[model samples]
Target: MAQIGLFSSAFFTLLAIIFCFIFRRQAWIALLCSSLLTLGLFMPVSFGVLLVGTTITYFLGNKSQNSSKIGVGIGILLGALVSYKLREIWMDSRSLSLDDFWNEDKPWQIIGLSFFVFNAISYLMDIKRGYIKSTDSIFKLAAYLLYFPTLYAGPLHRFNYLNEQFDQAKITKKSFNNGMRLILWGLFKNFVVAQRLNQLQIELRQSDIGGWWTLLIGFIFFFYLYFSFSSFVDFFQGVSEIFNVRLKDNFHKRVYLSRNRHEFWRGWHITLNEWFRDYFFYWQMKFKFWRDKPYILLLLTYLLIGIWHGITVKFFIWGFLNACWILLEKRWKIPERMEKNNSYKFLEIGYHLLICSLLALVFIFPSLEGLFIRIGKPNFLPMDVFLFQKRNVVIILAMCFMVDQYHRWSKDLRMDAYFESLPSWKRRLLYLPLILSIIFFGVFMKGMDNYYLKF
Candidate 1:
C-alpha cells in the first residue's frame, strides 16, 4: 500500500513537471497555482491563514501611505505570530505528561506560520524602504508568499530578489543537471548521514553512559541539526532550480569550520541571520540611543532570535549565552588577533566548534540539571560497546568530513564550475558512490522530519 501511494505521488509529480515545462513562459503562474493547491490539500487551515494574511498585506501595501502602512502591516503579521506562539506555550503548560510537554502535533499549531509571517513582514518593510515597489497584482504577492520551495522552511528570500528572478526565469540544460546534483547531494546528507546521527543520539541518551561519553552526544546532535537543516534547503533549492527559480543560499560550505561566532552565524542559516541583521538589528541601530549602546542592541537581537525559535525559557537562555559569546569575541577581537598565528587560529577554530557544540546541549536536553547529570557523572560505558554501536556513524562522519574538506579547498571556485572542469568519467564515478550510499544506508522509513521544520 505504501509503495503504491509512493508510486502515485511520483507519477503525479512527474506530470506536474511536464506541465510546467509545456507552459515554460508562464512557469511562475503554474508553479504558484500548483503550490497553492498542494498546500491547501495537506494543510488546509495553514493555507487559509496564508491566503487571508497575504490579501490583507496586499491591500495594506496598495491602499495606504508608505509610513503608516508599513507599521500596520507589520503589526498584523506580528500579532498573528505572537498569538500562535502564545497558544503553543499555553498548550505546553497544560500538558498532562512530560512526554506531551513539547508535543509537535497540536491541532491548533500552524506549520510554517513563523517563516511565512516573517517573509510577509519583510515584504511590507521592503516596500516602505523602497527596496522594491509594492505590487499592484495580488497574484504576484500570492506567488511570493506561496512559493512552495520556501513556503515551509525558508531561506527567507526577499520580494525584490524573487521578482527579479521570475522576470527572467527559464530552465536550461545546465540548470537541470545542477538541480539533479543538488537533489542527490541533499538526499545523501539527509537520509544517509543526518538520520543515522539522529538514531545514534537517541541511543546514547537512552543508555547509562555519562561524563565525556554524553558530551559526544551533543557533538553528534550539532552535526545532525546542521545536516538536517542544510539538506532540506538544498533539496528545495534544487526543486526551484529545476523550475528556473534561484532561491537564496542558506548555508555556506564551511560553516562548521568557522573560527568565530560571527563567522559561524554569517555562514549558518545565512538568510535568516541576514534578515535579522537588516530588518531588526540595523533598523534599531538607526536610533541615536541604540547606536550609542550597540552591545545592548546586539544582545536584544540575539534574544529576539532565540525567542523567535520558541517562546520558552530554554530558548531564551540559548539566545542569551550566544549573545555573551559574541560579545566576548568582539571584546577580545579574537578573530582579528588570532588570524596571524596558525597555532592560535587552529585553537580558535577548535574552541569555537567545541563551544557551539556544547551550547547545543541547551536545546537537546530539556533542563540544565539533566544536561549536567549526563555530563558530570563519572560512570562510563565500555569502550567496545560505544565503538561497536557507532562504528557506522563514525564512518559516515569521516566521509562527510572528507567531502567538506574538498569544498573548503575549492571555495575559490564555484562548485558547478569545479564539477564541470572534471572529466565526464570522473564525475560519473563520483556520482556512483554518492548514489550507492544513499540507496544502501539511507533511513527512508523514519526520521524524515527535519529539525528546522518545527519552527
Candidate 2:
C-alpha cells in the first residue's frame, strides 16, 4: 500500500493548486479554504496550536515597540521549538511512551512544530524590523501560517513574499509546464533513486556491514538522503511556482558540483543555512568575543543546525565535525592557482567523497558507540556479492550520475532552462515517458516518509 502521508500530501497539494487556478481572483480565500482542509486531514492538533500561536503573535508583535517585548516574543517561539525538540526526554522523565503520544485522547502531541516555530520567529522579527506590515486579517495570517506545501518540509517561505504573491501571482502556461516538469522529475528521483538505495540501506544496517563496506554504505546513505530531500524540494518548489510563489531554492547544482566542504554547506538545504546565518550567526557577530573568534561562531551555528535535527549525541558530533572542517578551511585557505589545477581538483573531489562518506556514518548510526563498534568490526564484502546484490540500484545510481553530469556539462545547473528551451512538441513528447515512468515506478511502490520530517 502507498504510504498514507505521501499519498495525502500529493493529493491535497494538487487539490490546493487546482483551487488556486479556479479562484485566482480570490487567492487568499482559496488558500485559506485549502489550507484548512489540509490541516484537518494531516495535522488537526497542529493546526489548532498554530492558529493559537499565530493569533497571539499577531497582536503581541504588532503592538510591541520595545526591544525587550520583541525579545520576549522571539524567546517564546524559540522556547516552544526547544521544548518540542527535547520532548522525547520530557516523555521519558514523565514515564510516557509511544502509546501516550499516539493515543487520540492525549491533548498535546507535536509534529512539524519546528518549521512553524521558525516561521513564527521570522514573522515576529520581520514585524519588529518593519519588514512586513502587521495585519489583523486572521484569514490571511492563518493562510500564511497554514500554507500546506511547506508545513512539513520547507524552504521556509518568507511571510512578506507569501503575502505579496497572494494577490500578485502570475501563473502563465509556460510556468505551469515548468512546474509539471519539476514535479515529474522529483517523483522519479524519490521513487526510483531514493527507494532503490533505501533497500541497500536496510540490508547494510542489518548485515555485518563493516570496513570498506561501511564507507560504501555511508555514501549510499548520503545519496538516499540527498535524493529524498532534493525530491521534496523539487515537488514543493514546483507547487509553489504554480501559485506564483517562489519558495526559496533549497538545493542548487553547487551541492553535487562543489569541490569543497564550505561550498557544500552553503548550497545544501540553503534556506535553513541562511536562516541560521541570519538569526544565529549574525546575532553572534554582534558580541565582541565571538566577533573576534569567528570560528567559535561557525561551530555554534553548525552545532545548532545538527541538534535541530534532534537532540542526539550523533547529531551533535555531526555538527561539530562539519564545523571543524569549515574552521580548518578558514585557517588554511587553498591557493587560487591550486584550486584551478586539474590534478588538485581531482584530489579534492576524492577527498570530499571520502570525508563526506565517513561523516554520513554519523547519520546512519544512532550513537558514537554503535558507529565505533561497526567500524571496528571489519567484514569486507565479496566484490561479486556487492556488485550483484542489487543490480537495479547500480543501474539507477549510474543513471542519476549521468543525468547530473549531463546537466553540469550543459551549463544548466537546474535542467529547467534547458527543458524550457526545447521545442513545444519536443517538450510534450518528453513529458509522456516521464508521466508513464512515474505511474509504472512510483505510484505502486510503498511510499516513503520524507526523511527530514522527523526533525
Candidate 3:
C-alpha cells in the first residue's frame, strides 16, 4: 500500500547515480542493492509475494525445459494470482461461508505483483523455449524481478532484454544527457500537469455531479492516466538509460496519431498489452477453433488485462467493452486512408478522444446500472458551466494538450538527434528550462503517486 512518493523518486535517482559510479562493471550488484532499498521502502508484506514468486521462478527456470515443471510453475503462479486477487470470490463460493476468511492480516499484497509475475512467467517461458541461457546467478535473476525503476509500475520489460542489457550496460555522455532530459520532463508532467488533474479528479469524486459532467470527468481521468503513467515510464526509462540498461520504449512516439483502437492499444499501456498479445493471444491462435474465431482470443486477452488490474467488476467491464470495440473496428476494417487529410485527421482524433473518454467511464462506475443512469440521462448543459467552474483544471488540460502536441511534432523531427547534434554549451542550455520547470512547478507537488501504482 506504500506508494512511491516524490522523495522516494529523488532517493532512487541519487542512488542510481551512485550505483552507476560504484558498480560500474557489476550492474548486478547495483540492481541487488536497489532491490533491497526498494523493499525497505514498502511494507514487508508487499515484498513477500515478490520474494516467493521470484524464488519459485528462479528454481523452476533451472528445469524449465521439463513440461511438468513448467506446468507446476504456471499453476503456482496462477494459484497465487487467484488466491490473492479472487480471495473474496473464492471465499463466497465456499460451503462454510467464512465471511472473515479474507480479513485475516497477512503481509500486505505486493504493489507490483501483477507486473512482476508477468516478468517471472515470461522468464520461465523464455527458458522453456531455450530463449534464455541457464545462469546460476541468483543476483541476475533477482535483479530482473526486483528492478526498482519499473517495480512500482512497469512498462514490464522482458527478462531476455534486461539480461542482455545488463551485460552491455555502460555509463556514456549521451545516455546521461538524455536521461537527465527525460527525468526533468517526466517530473514536470507528473507534478505540474497530472497533479492538477488529480485535484480535479478528487473534487469530481466528492461532488454529486452527473450527466455530461461524468463524461467530462472521464476525459480528465483519461488524460490524467496518460500523464501519470507515462511520466513514471519516462522516469523509469531514463533511470534505466542512466545505468545503460535502456529499457524498451513502452509508449509509441505517435500515440496521439492513432486512428483506431488497435493502434491505440499498440501505444497505450503497451508492455502490458504486448504481454497479453504475445503470450495469450498468440498461444490461443494456435488452436483450430480460436484460429478462425480470433475475436475469442481478443476478448480473452482483454478480460485478462482487466483481471490483471484487479478482480473488480469495473476492470472486467472495462476490458470486455474495449475488447468488443477493437473487434468491431477490425470487423469494419476501419480505413486508415481516410485519416490522411488534415481535416479528417482532426475529426478522427476528436472522435477517438470522445470514444476513449466515454469508455473510460466504465472504470469509474462499478456497475452497468449506474453507468446506464449517467448515459440515459443527459443534461444539455453548456460546456461553459464545467469549464468556468474548473478553470484551473481546464488551463492545465490545455497545457497538457500543448505539451503532447509538441512531443508528437518533435518526434517527427527526430528531436533527440537534433539535441545531440547541438554544441556542448547549447546542449547544457537546453537542460535549463527542463530543470527550471521541475524546480518551479514540480517543487510544491509532493507525495502524489502515479495512478498505475494502485494496479
Candidate 4:
C-alpha cells in the first residue's frame, strides 16, 4: 500500500478557521478540530481509511436514493469489517507476513477501523430508510466520520442522533461550562481511574487460580475495569456536549442498578443495544408473521453484535450467552417472584457480576479465546491473579465504584434555586474545592492511552 502523507496541525486548524467563518457555527469548527486532533494522534493508514470509508458511505447514501441498495451495501461493508480486522489472523494461518500495507506486521493495530466501518454501514442503512438525509459537503461528512473523540472507542452513535446535534441553537454559556467539565471529567476517568485498574487486571489475568474465594476476587477486579471504562463514557459525553455535538452514551447509571437482564441491556453500551434493536429486532416485532420466530431473530441479532466486537469464538459465545438471557427474559418476562423476592436480588447481582467478569476475559485471553479454552484456562492460588491484588489497586477500585455509586443518585449538573438560595460565601466555598480537584487531578493525569484506541 502507498504511504499517505501526514497533514500538519496547521492544515486542520486552517480548515477549522475557514469552516467557522463560512458556517458561523462553533460546533462545525469543534468537530473539524476533532478530526484535526485525530490526524495528529492516529497513524496515517488508520486515519486515511476512516476518512475514505466515512465520506464514501455518506456520498453513496446521498446519491443512491434507494434504501434497499443502501442496506445491501451496508451489509457488505459490515462483512468486510472482519476481513480488514483479521489481516494478522490470515497471515498467521499462511505462515507468511505480506507487505499488503505498511509492511509492519502489527497484529494489534487495527486502530478501531472496524468500529468505524460499523458506523458507516449503520449510517447507510439509516439513509436508505430516510432516517438520515445525506450530507452535501465532504468536509462535514468527514467530520462526522473521523471526529477523534468518539472514533477511538465509541458510544457508536447513529447518524439520526448525530444529525440532531447539528442544532443551530446558540452555544450558550451553560454549554461551554458543561463541555469543559465533561472533558476534564473524561481525563480523570481515563488516565487516572481506568489505567490504574488495568495494572491489576494485567497481573490477575496472567496468574492461575481456583476455588470460589479466588473467583470472587477475580470478579472484583473485573468490576473495577467496568467502573474505569464506564467513567470514560460519562466524561467524553460531557466534552461532546460542550461543542453542541452530542454522541450516544454507553454507560447508563440505571443499568447496573437494574434487577433484570432486559433492563441491564437497556443500560449497557446503549447505542449498540439500540442499533441491534432497530436494524434487526424492531422490524420483526413490527411484522405479524415473524412473532413466532422471535428466538431465531434474537439469536441472529445478538450473534452479529458479538461478532462485531471481534472475529473470535469467545466473542461469538459472549453474544450468544447474552442473547439467551435476553430471550429467556423475553419469553417469560422478569418473573414476579424474581423481581419481588428480596433473597433473589443477591443472586441476581452475583449472576450479573459473573456474566460481566466472564465476558471481560474474552479480551483478556485473545489467542486462547474460544469456549473450551475459556473454561479450561487456569483461573488458581499461586498462579491466580488475586494471589497478588495490590493495596493501591484495591483503594483505587474502591474510589472507582464509590464515584459510580455517587452518580447513581447525583446529577452531573444542577442549578437549584436553592443553590442560588444559598449564601454567596457558602456557594463559593463549595465551588472552590471542586475547581481545585479538577485542576489538580485532571490537568495532570493525561498520560495513558484511552482503552478504546485498540477497537
**Top candidate, metric lDDT:** 1
The TM-scores of all predictions, comma-separated, are 0.92, 0.89, 0.87, 0.77
lDDT of 2 by residue, 341-446 (tens): 7677767777777889889999767567888888887666545445665676665666477547545654734555567887889767766755665566453356
User: If the candidates were sorted by their TM-score against the true structure, best first, what order would they fall in?
Assistant: 1, 2, 3, 4
Which pairs, if any, clash in model 1?
Answer: none
Minimum summed lDDT over a 10-residue window in model 1 is located at 1-10
What TM-score, to 2 decimals, does candidate 2 have?
0.89
1-455 in candidate 1: lDDT tens per residue? Answer: 12222232234335447667777787777767766776676557778998999999999987454679779889999999988766546766686443353343444546578778988988998888777778989998888888767876588988878877776666688777776776677777888888888878877888888887676777888888998888878776766776677788888887777888988988898888898999999989889999999999999999999988778788899999999999999998877776666677777788887888788888778778888888898968656545766677675767687568657755854344456567899878777877888878778875344777656
In model 1, the runs with Cα more than 4 Å from the true position are 1-16, 96-106, 379-388, 409-417
Clashing pairs in 4: 204-385, 207-383, 208-380, 208-383, 208-384, 209-379, 209-380, 210-380
Weakest 10 consecutive residues, lDDT, candidate 2?
441-450
TM-score result, candidate 3 = 0.87
- Can you write out model 4's per-residue Cα lDDT over 1-455, one digit (the tens) per residue? 00111133224434543455565655565556546564655456676666667655765677676656676667667666777656646766887543343342452354657557767877777766666577776666666667655665577877656656755423556565665555545555555556566666556545554333344444655555555556556555654555566666686664555677776777777877777788779866778767878788889898888877656666677788888877877677665557667787877776777766665555444454332353555654553344355554565655566556545434533222223345779756544544554454332333433444434
- RMSD (CA, Å), candidate 3 to true, equals 4.2
lDDT of 3 by residue, 1-455 (tens): 22344556567667766786788887667766866685766546667768878888878777557467876887798788766777545554684232243222434446677777788888777777777765687778888888877776586888878878878776788877777666666777777788777777656655656677678767878878888888788776776677677766677766755767877887888788888877778867888999998877789889988877668677888889888888888777764555445567777777788888888888766466887776666554444445654766555866676576657546643334446666879877766755665566552534544767646
Say which candidate scores most in TM-score.
1
User: Which stretch of 10 consecutive residues in model 3 shows the poorest summed lDDT?
Assistant: 96-105
| Candidate 1 similarity to native, TM-score | 0.92
Higher-lDDT candidate of 1 and 3: 1
> How accurate locally, in lDDT, is each candidate?
0.76, 0.72, 0.71, 0.59
